[model samples]
Target chain A: MTVLAVAEHRRGDLRPVSYEVVTAGREAADATGGDLHLAVIGGDVESFAEDLNREGVDAIHTVAVGEEFDHGVYAQALTQLWADVEPSLLLAPNTVNGLDYAPAVAERLDIPLVTDAVGVDAGEELVVTRELYGSKVETTLAVDADRAAVTVRPSEWAAAEGHGDATIEPFDADIDESALGARVTGFQEVGGGDVDIGEADVLVSVGRGIEEEDNLDIIQALADALDATVSASRPIVDNGWLPKDRQVGQSGKVVTPDVYIAIGISGAVQHVAGMKGADTIVAINNDPNAPIFDIADYGIVDDLFDVVPALTAEFQ
Target chain B: MKVLVTVKEVAAVDDEFEIDGLAIDDRYLSYDLNEWDEYAIEAAVQISEAREDVEVVTVTVGGPDTEETIRQALAKGADRAVRVWDDAIASAGLLDPATKATVLSAVVEEEDPDLILTGVQAADDGFGATGVTLASAIGWEWAAVVNSLDLDTEAGVASVHRELEGGVEETTEVDLPAVLTIQTGINDPRYASLRGIRQAQSKELAVQSLSDLGLDAGALDSPMEQTSLYEPETEGEATVYEGSAEETAGELAALLREKGVGEA
Candidate 1:
């Protein structure tokens, strides 16, 4: 038995979670006394698979195929792969692509499905843990099924590198074209320049308290000083103050970083779902009663204009 | 063109949530219209106010609880309301929301709307797959995350201004009978009018169920699978380093360097 870690990619660039997933898969494989298998499925995934290879007892499986994630195709191929490999545990990132086909795979195999997991441990029965209810609580679940598939949240595990010249192998399956009923005729890739949120080390997020579009300069100045990315609550994006790429919420990009400094924002549940995975959550909001303060590891109550400038000057 | 927009009744975007073993405590949740769906409705109303033939209607999928969301839409001036309740689909063992979207798309196809709109993403799943999935289910031309729209019934085209990264906006002109996933910032969703608030109760709401869509809840394919729930590892402590500007700047740079930036 082995633990399979599924990697995510957009237009072929590997998602940072590939490292984190391997870190997670290694843990599961270690406890169950099995190997770790890293699977990359998409077009042009060879270079990505090699980068994610680990020496933790097993091989890397690359499902390089003509199919670019047709749900039925992925589901059927994964189901067959899991059956052939008979892994003790399977792990995937809790991502759009992962969520797309993971359930179908679980449903086909009759395995317990656990998602948005923060931690996992080995035991007589595998214990998968996830944050529940908007970062307010931690639920550690002892999955009731013998065979289990899980999607691990990104950034939770710092992928620990071990020594190995790990071997790479390509996975070829006889994909039934009929199963791939829906084909992606074209894809709109979110263009790049600064790092994607998943890979950012630090993020300075502004909430509704940012007040006006003019106030963003001080926030950007602060981000510039800190070399951090600028992000915001839905209100800012919805107000056309910023692009949708900057929106961080349940309806936006879920990000995990080393440091997340929230400024002038009330923590709404929607916003919390996205950034709850951050390592150090520092909230800067005037309202003590603001929902943001509840999940903030550290809190600052003051005017954002004054506070943000002070922080910017300090960082500069 | 009476535009009928569909919204979903989901765990509120603001509700406090808790998970006790297998059960999620939904008490803190307030059922409201999906935020992005509200934009679609708001856009429809704006079009109706500008055009003579257009009137906005609100449609939703859920159990009886969905009726409240419909009422809110009515209170905001939707001319009519329809509720499709497939209690079986509403109550299924599968954890996929796409299953719901699949059922919804099949039902929506029968309504024959000149154009259909949804939010770019739903708050609950944040999967952002519903609108695209619905479009595929019906085989309609689809454009996602549109910040603006202009409906031209004459040439049979819907002009959409799409939001992209780097503050880029793409203007797309799709032929009529298309699906648009409304982006945020389309317009502020309007509040209910007092006259309309009172009239909401008087509005005739036609309620249907999954049976009406001719869907056997079991036949739908649930694509996404979940494995287990794990709490995120806590990000380490972030102690505020308060000091003079010079001291803090020096400290901040040292910290960044320690994290391996500017090391080379």
Candidate 2:
């Protein structure tokens, strides 16, 4: 009876989403009265186990094949591993790759699966909380199972700090040549110039409020003056004005920046899905009724074009 | 070259959308062609459009109600559409993604398409499994989140543009008859033209049953049950900006700096 938290990574670096899963897994294991086990499935990702171990987990399971990024390879390997571990609660970060494999694992095992769970509680039945209606609702779910699985939403739980001896155990599986399904051949990271939303301490995010697509220079200038990273609501990403990587929302990345300055954003639920975790949220929008105001720790109900230049000069 | 594009229909995203227990209000939920599936349709449409020899066929498992989605795919330029009719599919014990992949792989075997396309994830379920699962069952090559694609029909090669973190685009060329799940930013979906819509009305969309694909209706046991559904909770307050750009910038910089945002 173990709780498995699958660690997500890129290259060799552990993604912040994985930490979120750790928090969620810790919660699940506590509820289920099971040991929490961290699982890493990337090539040369052994080092990540040590870092994940620092979060005070019991053990780190490594399937450190170079083919970690391959979806089918991952799904089949995890399925075989689950057979060996038989975790009472299986956890993964609700990410693109995680989504790809978790359901397949559920189907292969014929187990109950809950995805994108924002909260978890144990009892006679394992209760999970999920955000519905694009973060407008939090739905409580009670699963009928002794063993269940889920993908944890990012930023829902705090990543535990401090260290424990997270022992690493290597799991070997029969990964046939055909099982890989797709070879990455190679990979290219998007927007090499900007810091990721998950890593940024401070963020000056733009929404539709910046007006014209060309008007983004002001937000860019603000990011520069602040030495802050730039993130955006979904529209900016969908419109191609900003890279998809820059967009923050349910579909995009969820970030927990130190201070989030939302420029001209109306704070739609989809938009807030990305920035809700910021420590201090400052919203600058013309419309007072905009939902962005609902979450702002401090707000300025003024036209953005008027406000941006003053701030740029002030920061300068 | 035959290419299969799998798409689905789901509840529209709304700030007001909440699951009232087991039921959802489809009225307030505006349905469009599924957003992630749009990428799949675009991939197929582009392949067939650029390469004269490539044939794109779209598939989905739904009832008479989902015909609208299949027609929209035709407007986007898929040559034909297949609809597998099964209300049981929703509750039939088979995982929605795996079952769909099983059915899809079976269909593809008959059509023998070189390429298969599906959205990276379904907007409604967000399960994101059909493409890879189908590829695995069929034992074919696959790529995911491919933002750009250029097809070489003659050489049976596909050059794909992949999006990565940090704003980098990776382009790779692979042999034909592979599967690719499209990233959201691949290309803007083409609106169904009146002509295309009219043509779609007459196009042949073969509807099959779960058994037709050799899948038992009750192959899966749902491990989770929907105990309750409710609206998601909104956190915090909205901030409205006022005043001139200069004045606001001044106030904004002060606020930002206080938050450790501004360097100067």
Compute the lDDT for candidate 2: 0.72
**TM-score winner:** 2
Report the poorest 10 consecutive residues by lDDT, candidate 2 chain A.
A131-140
TM value for model 2: 0.78
- Per-residue accuracy of model 1 over B18-119 as CA lDDT, tens digit each: 444444555756666777888888888888888887767667766787788888888887778778766675666443434655666666766667777777
Q: Fraction of native Cα contacts kept in each candidate?
A: 0.08, 0.52
CAPRI quality band, candidate 1: incorrect
TM-score of 1: 0.63
- Top-lDDT structure, candidate number: 2
**Whole-model Cα lDDT of every candidate shown, in order:** 0.68, 0.72
Displacement of residue A227 (Cα, Å) in model 2 is: 14
Model 1, stretches more than 4 Å misplaced? A66-90, A99-114, A120-128, A138-149, A163-167, A175-205, A210-231, A243-261, A266-282, A286-298, A302-316, B1-6, B10-29, B40-66, B74-204, B208-264
